[model samples]
Target: MDINRVSARNVHQAHYELIVIGSGFGSTFFLDEALKHITGRALVIEWGDYQPWAWQVEAQSNSPIAPESTYKNSGNKPWNTTIALGGGTNCWYAQTPRLHPNDFKTRALYGVGHDWPLGYDDLEPYYCRAEQIMSISGDPDIGKVLPRSQPYPQPPHKGTSVDALMKAAMPDHHFICPTARPRMATANRSACCANARCSQCPVNAKFTAENGFPSLFSHPKVDVCLKSEVRTLEYSGNQISGATIASEGGEYKVFGDVFVLGANAIQSPAILLRSDIDYGQTGRGLHEQVGANVEVFLEGLKSLDGSTITTGYNYYFADGDFRRNRASCLVSFENRWWPFGLRKERGRWDEMLSLSVVVEDLPNPDNRVTIDPQSGQAVVDYRGESSYAKAGIEHVFDNLDKLLAPLPVESINSRIWRPTESHVQGTLRMGIKDDGSVIDQNMLHHRMRNLVVVGTSSFPSCSPAAPSLTAAALSIRAAELLYS
Candidate 1:
């Protein structure tokens, strides 16, 4: 696709009811819900192309394609989210886990992050709605754990050699069972038709923002500007007027009645910083929970030699630290290394299935994100620890080490790596008061009335489980705030 740019004035002088920025999961879910209530002209601006890029194919060549059909991030250019259509849903692991109610009330019960503005009960309907949209599949009855939605769209895929081996080795530690239902990829249909390890869904099984959002573009009222980038927000008075856009064709401006920032956690904060919009705590005190993988290769146990490795036991998800429990340290006997070589590490097919490891990370403010003056990009620096994260780490490795203790692949090695945040939250956090947060409980920007933020960034503290399901759920609630 060719790049083009237009002025905000030319694009929206007539005024659009809403303009959604970034086409990731947050925008997709929210926009879909918004259309249900507010019927007006909408505009969606995306920087990346809607189609798959060269890098995605390149990455797949390196590994057995991820069965869950997740977006493969190749650190080639600026982070790519689907710009042409579906956003990152074009590729995202379909693992959907809800926030245990304990996680939402953490701040009130435990002194971790602030308690969520809304509780699990308030968001339950949205969770149900999101589940239907994503077509989730899982067994929610794991003893005391509450299942957020109904049974997944499909039964959990069969476990692989690693799954069987872990069960044989340890009956004590329990890993959280992942849902096998398809992630919502498109709106009309909710499930994907693909293999367990298939990362790219063949039948729109997984729902991505693109799947839901393109409908908005098709609406006579909504106009989607592809490859158009928002560089700044043009505000007048307390309300937002429009936005300034930059693209290959140059600079332009766009006008909208309301502005919605769904640019993911990192980019949203970065955009605010670049726009010279500071809510005082805008970029300060950012938190990205860091994680590390610990590998255990069983001695004399060549049981891991298999083509399709699926099914996992994710024990150690809950050590009962409610405040920090949102950041569950997961231990799974799945493929150890990401199919593709991480960083600069070179690998072959054999390297992809070499061993399996579990990861535990602490949510630290030190491991936060800040703007770099030199490069002017958001940079992450992770360095924080919690007793729960540390304990979770220890528990996972201990369990793994014990399981493989008597096997030929006996050596157990644990190394700490810099944290990678999945359930990224808290940049534009919710709080009881204005000074304490970027947005109020309603997800509306505290300072800006016409702006709302949706996604993990709104999370004050990430829970221990998968945030995608919850993120989808909350955004549905956010859409309700606008539509309902």
Candidate 2:
């Protein structure tokens, strides 16, 4: 607790064997595994204070700092995030899906982007470990595509009638999406009650860092400081000395043998840029999936039998030869959501289904994160959305009619662009070359081996599925590879 006191009156200087910034999935999972191999003291610096689940539900807010205040955007679209102690874990939908095997070899397979330094097999065991810790709910058959090493902890959540139709038509492509929202009641969490609201789960069913990963903070060798903003890494040449932190009492520097930056894609790169640690396009190539929502009207089917808020994933468009010409998308079947429409025609009010297509984008350096001269906060200039992703959307438009032909006769209806998937990636990609990437496959900084950057910021490519599970898996792998 004395390390948290940042004033001239405090005579003792703060130092630790390990210093970790941010407490999201990347930080928590990495720490969860790293501490197993490490016996030294670790300090976690969190920018925002923790809010209880009840407070979050009543306030209808995840963090005291709204996402809009954290960054200055050049475009109308915004990046959604929770800036509290738990980070985005306080406000995620809990949809967990693994990246397709082909996603790792984009350059080798489709000649679009650089290949990931590592492959699915390297992270498969860690994926199983992360899934077990989260008690993920998923069907075993998904292994047909993802090649899982272990079965999910809980059985899959049931799908809606519409999902059944798609799975029946495309058996290999459609399956229940793995989710952190428990299917069976646990001592710490209740089973998901089809609450329909996921971001701010009204029932507190989703696995949040506060509830799911509480031990990471309470570990005997660990201590956490809230409301402590880390400004930059204090390093000389290739050695990391510590970090400069700004707190209410005063500004001071803290020392550590190792530093792990687990902040989000936007903030992590900003921290690196502020520290003057530019290696391999440090603040460039920032992106996420560009998604579009579609509605389907069925003549005879009645919807709403799904067991969770989001039920199934359609991977038919996620990978294939199409990547040689255009980008691909991952289709998600939205279930039990309120915003999905109802028909006005007599006796046909409940025959509609809502679907969303998430398209992966090729990273563009022109679309980047920079520092605002005045505010010093991150300034996101996102003018260049990949044309490949747009082309993928166009391809979907051309083939959706035929793809949905298996379902009952009705209209394909309208499509609306989603403002943000809230999944910021890239900026500090991992690869074998320091000239093109900031970190290596093990997540060690290309310049400073002691400085490890964990999280989606190290993602080499944008996968259409949510990156939380993958990020967590990568964290576990990084810890075992380095410390074990």
Candidate 3:
């Protein structure tokens, strides 16, 4: 597993068996799987420079917000993402929950959004593979809401004292959250020290693409180019011939047998739109989860002493008969101290607790990303269909007292707003029909045989669960299809 790292200026061999854009979970997982089957060379082009965890920790330590550039959005809602080597995994909190079985058949069951071309059973094996690679630790039995064929690689990470208290208070609700962070030292990475800054794990304990799948970069079959931005796909008829890439030196076309777009929800569609290949479905069905934050003063109770950020989950409201009318939500207990800027007394600050409620938003085709004709920037015209989400939020607020009855509650501040657009999905969605979807069940473009799109963009619908694990699983499945 020794990869050939090359600069755009030195790349004499332009042809590759596979060309994957972006080094995130979408492309990296696919590269790891594709390397085993394909003997031919594969190229992974990343737009951003490689930033190690050590460097990120030092750079983002003092700042409340991490240093990162975002894609322009005319709608004022910015996409919260990172373009580094590991992509969003470098900045994510690593809460990996498999989508519930019902999530795949949302159209059939709820009669709202389009159903996924493939079902949960189709992705279960790949999910296991991704979990093993990521060293996911969690109580498999606790994920009863989402059935799985196999157990997790490791047992659930130990919850903080506050989590225990919450569990004790709400015995009926499941509180454990499946996470990618290692419970104990394994591989070369250290165990989670509960530093409460998972966004920039100083010890590299979190399973980012760089640490989790090092072989993808080190493999002899793979050649990764950093700071190479793939501008557009060069297509002849029904196949993508090459990719026009913009590097620091100059623009160059890199030919490949097959091209995969793993550049995330925003950039992926932007690339497709820029290529002038209108599938009629590109940049459509854009949506994100409806998120609300509940700040409370836990009298005499101490919090923010746990591992990184999230510690517990209340899945009581994730799904139910309520899906017929509105979206369902999952409540997460935040284990990080608030009032991020000002210095606070350690003893007094421990009394603060934050509860995050994430409600599922139905995919609306009208709420989409369109490239500005003049500026050439991706403009997200997202008018959220939040009535359903609002209903769900109201339900959560009504049950707050009942859920936290056993615990001491002093003051509560509940605020609901549109999500930070972190979990972008449904732009280049996957479905059974070519007329409705950008890609098919295999994530291959409907019109272009050699073009495949991966990542959250291929998600038919956004569920309440965090989408990274599912995205990784989908990427692996697509890789298997491509190699076979």
The number of the candidate with the highest TM-score is 2
* Candidate 1 C-alpha lDDT tens digits along 1-484: 2223333445744568888897777777787778777667778787654564333445552123221122222231122223345455655656666666766776567666567787877887787788777655554443245545445554454454555555456544433345423433334444543343334544444554434343455665566676666777877667888787776667777777878898767667777777777674664444444455544444323333422233354543543653344345544444434432322323322222233332323334454556667655666553455565566555555565454443445344445544343445567777666655788777888778889888777777766565677777777887787655
Q: Can you give the lDDT of residue 130 in candidate 1?
A: 80
lDDT of 2 by residue, 1-484 (tens): 0223223223125788888899898998988888887878888888788787888988888887988888888998788877887888888899889888989999899999778999999989999999988889997878888998789999999888888888889889889888999899777788998877777788778888877875678788887877777888888889888887777767767788889998788888888888888888888889998988888888899877788988888878878888977887888887853455568889988788788888899988888899876656888999867789999987887788766766885887778888888998898889997558889999999998899999898988888889999999999999888886
lDDT of 1 at 20: 89
C-alpha RMSD of each candidate structure in angstroms: 6.6, 2.2, 3.0
The CA lDDT of each predicted structure is: 0.57, 0.84, 0.79
When summed lDDT is taken over every stretch of 10 residues in candidate 3, the lowest stretch is 61-70
Off by over 4 Å in 3: 1-3, 61-70, 165-172, 299-308, 339-352, 416-421
Q: Summarize candidate 3's per-residue lDDT along 1-484 as a digit string, tens digits.
A: 2446788766644899989898777888887888889879888898877776667889873223332333555566656767767788888888988888888887788776778889989999999999998988876656566677788887777666667877776655665678888887787678887776788887888888778876668777788888788878889899999888888879888899988899888889988998997795899888878787787777787767665467788877877667878887888887765433212557676777788888888888888878778756677787865687778888888888876766678767555554473888889999866558989999899989899898898998878788999999998999998778
Give me the candidate number with maximum lDDT. 2
Off by over 4 Å in 1: 1-12, 52-85, 160-176, 179-205, 210-216, 297-310, 313-317, 321-327, 335-391, 399-424
Candidate 1 displacement at residue 404 in angstroms: 7.8
Clashes of 3: 3
